[model samples]
Target: MTGSPLLALPGAVVGEGLDAGVAAHYGNPMVEQRRLEQGRAFVDLSHRGVLTVTGPDRLTWLNSMASQALDRLAPGEGAEALFLDASGHVEHAVHFVDDGGRTWLVVERDEAAPLAAWLDRMRFMLRVEVADVTAEVAVVGVMADPSALPAPHAADAIVWHDPWSAASPRGYQYARDPQHPASAWNWTELVVPRAWLSELADAVRSGRAEVAGVLALEALRIAAWRPRFATEVDDKTLPHELDWLRSAVDLHKGCYRGQETVAKVMNLGRPPRRLVMLHLDGSDTVLPVAGDPVVGEKVRPEPAPGEATERRVVGRITSAAMHHELGPIALAVVKRAVPATIELIVESHGIDVAAAQVEIVPADAGAAVEVPRLPRLGVRP
Candidate 1:
């Protein structure tokens, strides 16, 4: 594992056995316990992006580049945005927040520099300055009452706040604000002095919160059906396919890199595959792993009471986790035409396992309602 100064903090423990591509940590037990109890926890999110947007045209430039309307992001408020390819596939996910006069962009760590470069190239005549602040800013995750803290303080040290009633997934940093507790909300980034992180950790440790590990976080995310960056989203995924239309894409926003494709998909019909939640058959001795084939209809008609042969290949599993509450919950991207409830099999470790009673929903059905599009930077197209 590469050495990161951020991970070297006292009482911080790195995730064991993970490869180089993944970076995760378990803060001191005390901090984790307090976070769990108060539903407020903080972790080192340095592995993610930290971008600084300065200069007069910062807001205008950002509003044009991302799928969200950035021009209207008032100080202490933040919005979720996406950097899409020409075809509207998400290249990177971003959290845009206003910090006093400057704007900060929190993105996936690996994408920070590339996105910065892309923005710089598009600066043609804009007066905005883009710089990668991944190394400078220490990103931490906080889940708590947003009303307790102001926006400026949130944005400075706490780079991201989701502010959703339900806890956000592992990679996502969200807070449950009193104002918009049920809805998906964003928060201002708060900057914590590096020297003070230890003190904060101590304070949290002394409390009742338990440090949550990646596995625990995964369980929380799976239950919510929140798609992750690399795991649930990738090159082949369209924003709409992953159920990201509600949060990542601003349909009413002006033209962006992939607006044409997004609009076409929306105006035309559903994508080939849609994201859905899976309820695995408990009797199956072996559990299905991700990437296992989702039997489609061609093999046979739907299972007819204890018939194992009535299965066909349809799609594949994207993510699966054994839930403490739900007992073996999974997320899969299956063919659009498949029945809402069907019996499928996932092959894990050379074992064929049955998946029963999958609850399928159209990727775009509930998300097509008209909402406020992020305000554009300049004039409308």
Candidate 2:
């Protein structure tokens, strides 16, 4: 993991493990989170990966392989796409934007190499060229508005504004909440030269702009019901389970790798699992981390003896955070059979913490289209 120049600032605490080499916070996390919420701060995501694809065949080639319709994506417009395996499981969640000549793909830190290799293999006879430029550029994240950054830096930066709030014409939304939290999630990522990181650090130090840590950014993302590939996805995860079809999967687009399963789930079957926001019990002062088991009681039928009910694992927490206002919250993916009305217990550090379910993906999250039944031969109209 390459270190960011901002880590040299006073009170900057570097993150550990997977978030190594990045500042987790700068002395005061609460204040930083508030600044971020108000669009007054920027997050140093230089640790994330950046890839660039350039060629005349770039748009058409990517559109044929990606779940999103990218063939007609105009320059400066940003979109999300999913690269799924043959079995319809999500392999990658890509955020990309084109600047006419070049297309930039901003992905999770660990995905850069693998994605580049895969794209290179798929190039075949196409003119597209894939290069992992993670070391050449840094990814800076801004919320609400991106124009708050300093003048010269913002002028030459390539920005990828998130399109999660809007409905895709070729996609379908499974989460039917009238007031979805994502409507306020105006997130954007800017690609800037790595050497310019010091300028951003100076801005933070001089009060020209504020800076927030990854923790603050993640808390707000979970609150917004945003699905990040790194945290929310696993081997068996499907896009419908996270309501990702709303932004990443194009239902009406031409066939891709997992189009059969995507179509079947959307038109005839429901996803096996569903995503839910967990409002955790903060009394224990313990927030369950990612991969924590979510358990619930279930009735066992035809028990051998006196066993009438037992506790069973129903789901697992994908991401958890301590929000500045919302207290402790998490996003979990649970079995579709898990009743939304039931209170779940999160097993965190051998302690059971109560979690109330806030429905994100409904139990019946697929089979969206209504199919008409044919009349029998002898039946009247």
Candidate 3:
């Protein structure tokens, strides 16, 4: 991994491994979060990756390949797309923006190379040109600034403005919030040159620019109930379960790789699982992290003397955070059969915390197919 540019800023703490992976914070997440919510700071997203596609057939070709209808994507327009296997399992979550001359894709850091390679293989006779541009560009997150950085690539820093602030175009929202946290979500990622990082951080220190860290961004993102490809997706993940129809998957788009499964599940079957926001009980002072087992109160066999019944694992936490206002919160994936009123427990290192489920997708979603009535003895011959 290359050194991140935000390290030039004072008090920068780079979180290595799965949890932090990038600049966790410049000391205090609360202060940084305040700065971000107030549009006074930016987050360093250089650890992520970027890919660009250019060609006359880019839009139409992409339209036929992904989950969204991209053929009509106008310049400066942005939309989310998902790459799925033929079985409909989510393979990749894509953030895309078209700037007329080029279509930029923002993906998880480790996925850029593989995604570009896949695109190349699918370009047999199309005019599409695919390139992994991670080495040439960096991603910077901001609450409001859209100014391009002073670098060749940054000259037209393609900004993929987040559409989570409101209900997406023709998308379905399962959760209703009168004052949604995303309502103030002005998150935007700026694609800049790798060399411009230090200058941007310096601008933050000299009071010329404002900056935050990934921790603050994560906290706010989790609070908004947004799903991220890095932490939220697994090999068995399905878009409908996450309520991703709010942005990623369009129900009326032309056929794509996994359209069969997507359409089938949307019209005839219910996803095996559903997404929920967990309002965790913080009395234990223990917060669960991603992959923590979400155990429910299911029937268990009798225990021996001085023993406790074994509770079956019903779900797993995908993301968790301590929000400035919402306190400790998390997002979890649970079985579709799990009842809405059930309370879950997160067992972490022998500590247990109570979790209340807030529905993102109703467990019974898409299970409305009618069954035929059997003929009775008194029926007409």
Quantify all predictions' global Cα lDDT against the true fold: 0.60, 0.89, 0.82
| Candidate 2 residue-pair clash tally | 0
Per-residue lDDT over 91-123 for candidate 1, one digit per residue giving the tens place of the 0 to 100 score: 888777787688877766667788888888988
What would the TM-score be for candidate 3 when compared with the true structure? 0.91
Residue 378 accuracy (lDDT) in model 1: 91
Winner on lDDT (2 vs 3): 2
- Among these predictions, the greatest TM-score belongs to 2
User: lDDT at 242 for candidate 3?
Assistant: 82
Provide the clashing-pair count of each candidate structure.
30, 0, 1
lDDT of 3 by residue, 1-381 (tens): 567767857888887655345688889998888888777777888878799999999999888889988888999889889999998989988889999999999998888889998999999899989998888888887777564233343356778888777777666665554665667777888877776777886676777776777878888888877889888889999888887878788877757999898878876788889888999999887878889999987644765687765587889999888888888889999999988888899987689999998887776676435656689998897
Candidate 3's C-alpha runs over 4 A off are 18-21, 145-156, 176-181, 299-310, 368-381
Best candidate (score: lDDT):
2
Overlapping backbone residue pairs in candidate 3 total: 1
lDDT of 1 at 282: 62
**Number of the candidate with higher lDDT, 1 or 3:** 3
What's the best-to-worst order under TM-score?
Answer: 2, 3, 1
Runs of candidate 2 exceeding 4 Å displacement: 299-309, 372-381
Candidates 1 and 2 compared by lDDT, better number: 2
Q: Write the per-residue lDDT of candidate 2 for residues 298-351, one digit (tens) a residue.
A: 766667787766899999999998999999999999999888798899999989
